[model samples]
Target: MDAKLLEILVCPVCKGLLHLDKARQELICRGDRLAFAIKDGIPVMLESEARELPADEEVGQ
Candidate 1:
């Protein structure tokens, strides 16, 4: 993901800042407990496209 893009990216549902999960290729929204996937180098920011984060999932600091 582009640095500038990541800096501006936010959760579609809650308008919260996102954390890039490089290993999973997803942008994590802690406030919303969602993970927006990065497909073909572009973020899928739609709420319908997001995956619900599991309780056991670990988010980056």
Candidate 2:
């Protein structure tokens, strides 16, 4: 993921800050409990495309 893009990216649902999970290739929204996937270096920010984060998942900063 591009560093510039990550700085500007936010959760579509909550318009909140996102934490990039490099290992998972996903942008995590703690507030929304969603994970937006990064496919081919592009973030899938659509709510319909986001996956529901497991309740037990740790959203690390």
Candidate 3:
């Protein structure tokens, strides 16, 4: 993901900062516990389309 784009992207639900998981191609919102998918270098920021994080998952940089 582009650094410029990642800087501006936030969680749709809580407007919180997102951590870009480049290897997984997902933008993770810890506050909302959601993972927004990034497909073909484009982030899919829709809340309805976000996937819920697994309860056992640990999120952060």
Candidate 4:
């Protein structure tokens, strides 16, 4: 993900900050408990396209 893009990207549902999980290629929204996937270098930010995050998952940069 681009550093500039990550700085501006937010959760579409709650307008919350997102943490980039580079290894998993996902953007995590802790407030909404959701994860937006990055497919082929493009972020899928739609709420319907997002996946529910697991309780044990940790959010980090």
Q: Tell me how far the alpha carbon of residue 20 in candidate 2 is from the true structure, in angstroms, after superposition.
A: 0.5
Runs of candidate 2 exceeding 4 Å displacement: none
Give the CA lDDT, 0 to 100, for residue 37 in model 2. Answer: 93
Model 1, residue 46: distance off in Å is 0.8
- 12-52 in candidate 4: lDDT tens per residue? 99999999888889999989889899999999999999999
CA displacement after TM-score superposition, residue 32 of candidate 1 (Å): 0.6
Model 3 regions lying over 4 Å from their true place: none
lDDT of each: 0.91, 0.92, 0.92, 0.90
TM, every model: 0.93, 0.93, 0.92, 0.89
Lowest lDDT sum, 10 consecutive residues, model 3, at 52-61
Clashing pairs in 4: none
Error of 2 at 6 (Å): 0.6
TM-score of predicted structure 1: 0.93
> Higher TM-score: candidate 2 or 4?
2
Q: For model 3, how does the per-residue alpha-carbon lDDT over 1-61 read when each residue is reduced to its tens digit?
A: 8999899988889999999887789999998899999998999999999999989988867
lDDT (tens digit, per residue) of candidate 2 on 1-61: 9899999998898899999999999999999999999999999999999999888978868
Root mean square deviation (Cα) for candidate 4: 1.2
